[model samples]
Structures are given as C-alpha cells and as structure tokens.
Target chain A: MSAPFAKLPRWADYGLIPLINLFVAFIVAGLVVMLVGENPFRAAMILVEGAFGRGQNIAYTLYYATNFIFTGLAVAVAFHAGLFNIGGEGQAYIAGLGVAFVALSLDTVLPWYLTFPIAIVAAAGFGALWALIPAYLQAKRDSHVVITTIMFNYIAGSLMVYMLVDVIKPLGSMAPQTRPFEAGAQLPKLNWIIELFGAKIRSAPLNLSFILALIMAYLVWLLIWRTKLGYEIRTLGFSSKAARYAGISESRIIIITMLISGALAGMMALNPTMGDQHNVSLDFVSQAGFVGIAVALMGRSHPAGIIPAAILFGALYQGGAELAFEMPNISRDMIVIIQGLVILFAGALEHMFRPTIQTLFASLSPRSVGLAAAKKEGA
Target chain B: MDFLNALVLILDSTIRLSVPLLLACLAGLYSERAGVFDIGLEGKMLAGAFAGAAGAAVTGSAWLGLLCGILVSVGMALVHGFASITHRGNQIVSGVAINFIAAGSTIILGQAWFQQGGRTPALGAAQRFEAIELPGAAALRDVPLIGQIYSELISGHSLLTYFAFLMVPFTWWVLYRTRFGLRLRAVGENPAAVDTAGVSVAWLRYRAVICTGILTGIAGCYLSMVQNAGFVKDMTAGKGFIALAALIFAKWKPVNAMFACLLFGFLDAASIRLQGTPIMGVRVPVQLMQALPYILTVILLAGFIGKAIPPRAGGVPYVKER
Candidate 1:
C-alpha cells in the first residue's frame, strides 16, 4: 500500500503539533467568550496579568501548579504502563485522610520537618491502597479499570463525607472538618523566594511543597527513564503482547505501575492540606486530579513536559479567579471550559490536523518524504 | 395503613427519580451496543438540561425546549463520533472532555445569558411538563391498596416518564426484532464482517450515536422541565454515572437495564426518606446509602454477581486491514 501520510519531523511532532492544538483550543475558548458578549482579547490579557502581574499572583500560580505537578506525574506514570488511572481524584482525596491523620497525631510533639516525611508516606500509602483494588480487578478479573476507577471516585466521595460528618468532625463543631493542625503541621510559605526577586508575597500559599513537587518531578524522571521497572513499564505500554512474549508478568507490571501512579496522586494532598489549608477541607483537592489528565495529555506524558504544562494550568486557575472577580459576566467556570477544550483538542482530536499538515510537508520536499518512507520500511 | 402509605410514597419518588436514569441507560445501551462506548452521558444530559431550560424559558414552549436540547446533545455526540470514530482517538478521553465541557460551559453560558448565577429563571407552568393523571384514577382512589399503587405509584407522572418506561419495551423490540437491530449488534460484535457485507460501519455507528443523543436529551429535558421546573448547575449530578452503573449491572440488556435503574432509584428514594431516621435503633449514615450504588456496581463488576462483558468491538475504532 502507498504510504498513508508523511512522517513528521521530530520538532513538528513533539512541539509544533501540540502548539497548534493549544492555539485551536484557545481560539475555541475565545469564541465561547465572544458568544457571552465579552471581548476575548481583553479577558485573555486580564487573565495573563492576574496570573503573573504581581509577586503574590505568581506565588498563587505556582501554588496551584504544585498540585498539578503531583497529579500530572501520577497520570504520566500510569500512561507509561498502558493504564488509565482516573481514580487520582479519589486517591488524592483519600490520601488527605492519611495526611490529616499523621498531621493531627504528630503536630503535638514533632516538628514540621519530622511530620512532613511521615505525612508523605501516609499519603502515598493510602493512595496506593486505594488503587490496589482496581489494579487487582483489571489484572486478575479482566474488569476494565476505567469504570471501576470512576466508581471508586464516587465511593471515595461518600467515604470522605462520612468520615468528615459522622466520625471525624469535632463535637460541637458546626462545620464538617477537623480542627486546624497546630503550627508544626503547617508547611512554611516560600515568601523568601518572592523576596529574593525584590518583591513581596502577599498572602499567597506558595510554600515548601513547590520544592517538593519539583524534587518529585526529578525523581519521577529518574524512575521512568533510569530504572529497570520504568523500562518494563514503557515496554508493556508499547505492546502488552510483545511484553508477554518477552516473559514480563503483565499482572505484576499493571499492579506495580498503578500503585506508583496512585502514590503520586496521593502526594497531591500535601500541597493543599498541609501547605495552604493546614487542615483537610472538603474540597481541598478541588478537581486537581482531573486537571492532571489534561496536563499529562498536553505534556505528552513526560515529566520534562509536565512541569511546563502544569504551570500553564496553574496560570489559568489563578488568572481565572481574577477574571471572575473583574468580569462579572465571565465566571471562573470559563477556565473549566478552556480546560475541556484543551483536553478535546490536545488529547482526543490530536490528529485532526495531522493529515493536512503531512500532505503540505510532503509537497514541500518530496525527497525528505521519500527518505522517511524508506527509513520506515528499513525499520 | 401508615406503612403502606410510606411504601407508596417511596415508590412514587422511585419512579420519578428512575425516569432520567432509565432514559439515559437506554441511551447508553444504544451507543455501546453499536460499539461506541459513551461515558459522556452525564455531560450530554447536563447540556440538554441547560438548553432545555433556556429554550423553554425563551419560547414559552416545552416542546421547543426539547428540540433545542436534542439539537445541542446531537452536536456533542457528533463531536465524540468525529474523534473516536474518524480520528480513532481514545473514547474515554473524548468522553471526559465532553463532560468537562458540558460542566463548565453550561454554567458559564447560564450565568452570562440569564444573570441568575448560572441558572435560568424558574420556569412558568406553561413552559413546564406538568404531570398527567391516568384515566380512571379518581374513581379508583377509594380502592385501598390497589388504589394507592395505581393512583399514587403509577398514575401521576409527566408525559416523559411514561415515554421512558415505554421506551424499554420499544428498545427491546428494536434490538431483537428489527433488521437494523441485527446489523447494529453484528457491527458492534464484529464490524469487519458487516463491512464485508457491504454496510458502512461508520454510518450505522453514527445513527446509534444520534439515537443516544435523542434519548439523553429527553432525559435532560425531563430533569429541567418536568422534575425541577428549572435548570441548576451540575443538576444532572452523578445520575449519569448511576445509569452507567445500571447499564453494567444489567449487562447491557434493555429489560434488565430498567430493573437495575429501578433498584438504584429505590436506593435513592429510600436514602432520602431514611435520612436522620434510625434504622433498627441505629442511625445509618446517609453517605453510606449514597455510596451504595457505586459500591454494589464495583462488586458486580468484580464478578461477585456475574461478569459484565461489553460489546466485543467496544471502544476500538474499525480499521480496515491494508
């Protein structure tokens, strides 16, 4: 058969295509803004200014990005293993319980540094436990992980509500949350970082967790690219049949990969619960787990890519809040619309423009196209 | 007599609540049976609810509201089809995107246009679907148990509720008896065979997707116009997921789907009634009851009941071998 389409150059494949998709997504989001009778460019300008205009704004953006970084890493790990672990929302929320439990117990005696490591372990443990059942089911029972994970999300919501309302809420407390942790449990704010830039951070929740997120990103890179397990995961993701032929245990890989994914998702709780809220609130995760899917997709499931994508989303979240305050007509929900459009364009309809672009490139230089075809045949 | 009245009351609510789930389950049944898995039922229903409320409020006609909802929902379905069918994109990712789009855009547009903070004006009676009392219900009201069951549990509901129930049998007939039904099922199980038989797999799947849009639109219209009288933000809530769970619990069969939805609806209605009420001298947490449907589905999916195998070709785009 004739070559279906010309192969894209590395730069065009990795960089240009995603950029075009992002541009299309923004254009659609802008059209949505225009439909509501708002000027799209002004809204965009306000959004950008709100995200990066001040030191506090930048701090807030990073604060949001920290959560996305954790979640994005979670999704990317699973993507490498050919698994879709959408239960990150539930896992992270449940991990809050572990974090809160550790924080509540240790805050009375331990210092912030001591409590922090224990909280991370607790969070990762809970998240991994949450993912275990779905992983087991997918590996052993042949049940699809997607539906089960979605179900687990609802189950997690119910469990959290019960824990908050009936079991954990302090007596005589009207609200459904634990009493605030003592000072030892709180992560120190990264106000000094802003100060070093000759600007003051005013009430933004940017904290030590941002550094933790970056460290985790680096560790994730090491794990996926430098470790044997990472090689196995990538191999399995490429083709389970091939992995099986190579004598890899499919069930073991699936479960282990999902556990790692769940742990990363769980660590996301550390940001909001410890860094900012200082207590486990009902909406602490606040859909950051879902945001991870978009980040992972936009980043092409790489840590190198995820950090920047997470920051972009963080900007959207921070700026969207400002936009809501300034523009009465456009609420913060507009950011969610942009998010959905990004997922649709960047993730699902990624190849919508590929064929046309390929044809254009083929016509530009037939020699390169022929060379690429020959290379493919040789490979 | 008191116990019976309570039972009837819960059953009445059960039917009302089940209507949307039933319609949505059937909608999923059609699309999934045609090998196109749909996790976007929630999003479509939410969008439909908003469009239905807005359309009815604007034109002062419930019928026109339904038309608007159907049109919008169909538009979304076509997008899903384009991605999953044409581009061979991940079905779950496409579904997730649709849901987020619906969740975000409905509220954004609702706030922008109506200015009621992401809600349309409370609909007028003329713009709503009022319940219909079945014939002879008044005469049978004095007949005790039968009377209560007939008049209270079954008789009073909007036109859409009856249609939802009716669609079950109709759906069964369509799936089992019609030539199109055979082709649809065959295409889902093995698309290549149908393609070799000179039928376009894409066209058949598109038709199924459109049917899903229509049914889900009705479900949405029912939510806004019949059940609540106006649209609310995230009003569909997790009902779409419950319908999905019900679909799995039913193993994608039409008759079984109705019963599964009814079971879930009963759980919901009972939970509402059981709130703050001690059961056997113990206060049951409402959250447990709220989570029961999901937990039970997971259990069933794990093969505690029976395996729920989807259509053989589900979620995979038909790629002709070169």
Candidate 2:
C-alpha cells in the first residue's frame, strides 16, 4: 500500500532493483535445484557454461534470444499505450499460418528471395489482422483486451489444428506439420554471412531473424522515443482523459499500437519455422510469447533494456535444455519455474524492495532527497 | 429411435462436461465478485488435479485425494492473495505468476515423485470416484422416453457432479440472501463503502479467493477422479480461462453462469460428435469445434450475444489514501 510513497534513486530505480530481483529469482531457483539434491553452485556454473561457453552454444542462445526479442518488444509497445496485450501468443500462432501459406503455395513458383519478402509480409500482416479484432472491440465495444486476446489464443490453436489435420497435411503424412519449405524459401543462416569476415563460426540455427529483430528493436526505439505518434501513445498510456483533452484519439492510438505489437509478435514465428524447422508445426511459437512478458517486465519496456533481458531468458532456455540432458533429476520444467520467479519478482513483486532501497539512497544523499520526493507515487 | 439415442448421448456428455465448468465458473464468480480478477483458475485447477491424482495414488482413497486437491488449490489462492491483496501488487501480473508457478511446480514435482512423465498412475476403482445410482432408477427403467432420460441423464453421474450443480443455488442464496454476500458484493463495487461500514475489505477478498480455490478444487478433482483416469501434465488445459469467459458471458451471476457453462459443454460435446462427420460431403472441422466456446465468448464480450458489465472496481487494488 505504501508503494506510491517509495521514491527510489535513478540508478537504484533503473539498474539496481532489476538486478537485485534477478539475483533473488536465481537464488530461489537455486534453492529449488538444491531441494532436488543437486549442488546449486554447480548447476549455476553448468548453466552459464552451457549457454555461453562454446561458439555453437552462443549461436543457439542468440537464436532463441531473437524470438524473445520479438515477443518482448510486442509487449512493450502495447504496455506503453496502457494496454496489456496478452494475445501475443495467439497472434504469433495465427501468424504461423501466414508463413506456412506463403511458403507452401508460392515457394515453388517464386525464387527464395521473392518468397522471403512475401512470407515476412504475410506473417506480420496476418498477426496484425488477428490483433485488429480485439483492438476494435476494446476501442469501440468496451471489451477487455486481456480476455479477448486469451480467447483468441484458443481460437488460433483450433485453427492450426484444423489446417494441419484436414486441410494441409500434404496427403499421407500422419504428422501434424507441413512439408518442409522449398530450398529457395529457407532463410539463410548467419554463418554464411558471418563467414565473410574470415571467422569460422559454425553453422547454427542463428539466422537472418536475429538481424531482423535488431532492426525491429531500433525501429521501436525510434517510434517510441522519436515520433509524434509515439508521444501521443505514451500520453494515452499515462492518462487517457488527458490525451483526449489534448485532441488525441484514444481509439486510433489503441488500434495502431496493437497492430504494431501484433506484427512484432507474428515475426517471432519466423525464428522457429523459417530459421530452424523449415516448416510449420503445432506450438512452434512454444512459450516464447509468454516469456516476452517477463522480458519486457525485466527490461522496463525499453528496447535498449530488452536486448540484454531477452538474452538472459535465452540463456536460461538453452541452459535448461543442456541441464535436462546432462542431469537426469533436474528437468526442463525447472526453466519455467525460473521464468516464473523472474516474472514474479520483476513484474508483480516489483516494488517490494523499493521502499527499503529508497530509504537507503535518501539517507546517503541529502540533495537528492528533495528531488526524489517529487517522484513519490500514490499513497 | 436411433436419432433419439444419439441425442441422449450428446446430452449426457454435455452434462458431464458442464460439471467442471460450472464449478469453475462459480469459483470465479466468488473471487471476481469480491474484486479479485483471477486469471489463475487454470493454475489452481491444474494444481488440484495433480494433488488429487497423486493423493489417490499414494493413499488409495478417493476421498483423501479430494481433500488434498482442495488444500493445494487453497495454497495457491493464498499465494495470490498475499501478492495482490497484501503486497498491493499488479493483480494480472500476480495471477500470471501463480499460473507459471502452478504449471512449472506441478510438472517438476510430479516428475520427481512419480517418474511417469509428470503423471500419476491410473487410479483403481476404490481410488477413483464411481457413478452413484439414484433411487427409483430401476422402477423408471420400464418407462419410455422418461426412462432413458432418468437413467442416462439423472441417475449415473458421480456425486461431485450433483454437488457442482447444487452449489449453483447455494451460491445464489449466499450471494443474494446472506449478510456476508452483501458485504462481498459491496467490496467489489466499492471497497471504500465496505471499509466505511466497518468491514475489512482485504479479509473479505481473501475469504472469497479461498472459496474460489475450494470450488475450483472440486472441478479439478472431478476431472482427475471422475471424468478421466488420472492427472496428466496441463490436464486442466484452458478450462479455467473458458470458465472465466463463461462468468463474463453470464454477467457474473451464479445461476446464469450455470446455463452458460452448460451451453459451452453442449458445444464441446457437439463438436466431438460432429468431428469428421461429413454433412452432405464436407467433414466438420474439429478445430472449429474446439474453438466454438472461445468464438462464442468473443461474441458475447463484443456485446453481440448480450450485455456484459463487469464489477466497477474489478482489477484495481483498493487503496485507502492518507
């Protein structure tokens, strides 16, 4: 209840709080690992070594990080506009249909270069279209965005199930995935491009999607921090009534923000389907869409902050896979618990340690005391 | 005669499916009515299913399994209350954490204990809920249409199913007739009013949340012990979300929630029946069938099916300013 009264210092607010939260989550996760009879320190060492020790490991880490980046940015965009678009998971799933449709139908007739653009456009367009319905409902019909989006996730799953089983099974295959994309449609791996610099980085799933994600992060920064629309969107998030009084259309901003967010989420499908799997399958989005919420929360919904936050999650994932294989007792679901802890600490329990930190900082610096008081929140 | 039998079968399955949804819907009604928007119903139900299945496997008693289910669900609800109510945390964020914790911990602990792919062993007759035969079923068996209806629809359901339906009227009475119900409703609409009236809003909300956990526990237990053989990973699936949607569609009314859940259950049963059943040459899509409830929920939320007005103070942590 006193959360609004906590006036944390700038460094403590932006840097220390998240770092401390991250440390606590890891510590708690370590305790869980210990509960399972494993040495906590050894497990942490294995996790770090497995994620970043080898060149190939780093590539895979980045590959997974790319997916998180897309989803994280999607969440950040919506959050800035004061909307929680939990529908990122559904949007990504729906977007996979677009990627599959393009790769299946047009890849044979067109070159890979041509098919590449077509698939990307299809993915983003489909994702945005899926988000548009909920956005319109929230803007016009007063339906809650969270409920609508969650429902759409189920709807999207059903759509994919229908498509895979009845409509596009490629004749006799009992498997639920489509046939692999044509060689022309396959996205190029990063090794090919990076090899030009005379460094021998091994071939990995890390591909063009990573670069595309970076470009997206930059674009998001420019849109949020630079553009007039970005300014309006933030204002809307801060106070919708104030935004309305300032002549901004609440509905228009909601729609636009959601569309852009959905587009980013859709792009996540490309990491698995195009970069690695080379085909569409059930649950290819995995839980990346959900992990994005953790990433965005940890990153404070900023592009610069999201990149590292995404890599941390990416590391947890890749390391988790390695641990599952190496240690029989500890399973991959432990990673989920770790992700949950991070989300719990960084998002829900975010202000738990703030008051204590603020008191410490205020006591240390008298000049900042007056300035910090100006930033105090609700009672 | 054949058509009538098929119709009877569908109706039977509908009732079976609706029992869990009905329980979950009522659970959500209790929580949301007290101003705590619970998206963690899935998590709580999943935890309950795991506990029920695991308990039955351990003790070989279905009754003990049911008790274990309730305890685990209540623990989860308490965690949610500690975060959202006590810490004044973001309610949605806290709910999401509970979901993640429930999902992750269930599997991790399940795999640790059973080593059967996060699933307990299939329960035996004594360890699983059995269908109870109602009185006069044998006498009614001789009757024609009424005979089949009585035997199939009314007589053979597990005890939990009856309890779930019975809870509807019980919930209605509690929310409408009792003093506690009035205070609970007042807290949701305006916590300040309740606080001014010398009632503790936090205590009321915590109790409401705990009741939700208990109801959701019954739903979860029914799934593991009655509907199916045992608990599997993510067995609750998205049933919790569907229940929430039903609560919304019913406009947060306990009795209306029962009808809404039954309609959804009917849709589910119809889809299963219609799956791959060619209607004049084209097979009906199972995916569309699976998606039916969600689509209906969206329509309802969009105000096409009906008007849905949420509690005014839902989702906002009640803050008493200095």
lDDT of 1 by residue, B28-115 (tens): 9999999999999999999999999999999999999989998999899898999998888888999999999999999999999999
Worst 10 residues of 2 chain B by lDDT: B283-292
lDDT assessment of candidate 1: 0.92
On TM-score, the leading prediction is: 1
Model 2's CAPRI class is: medium
lDDT accuracy of residue A73 in candidate 1: 96
Q: List the candidate 2 regions with Cα displacement exceeding 4 Å.
A: A1-6, A109-111, A192-203, A371-379, B279-282
| TM-score of candidate 2 against the unseen true structure | 0.95
Fnat, 2 decimals, each candidate: 0.82, 0.69
**Across residues B100-179, which tens digit of lDDT does each residue of candidate 2 receive?**
88888888778778888888899999989899999988789779899999998899999999999999999999999999
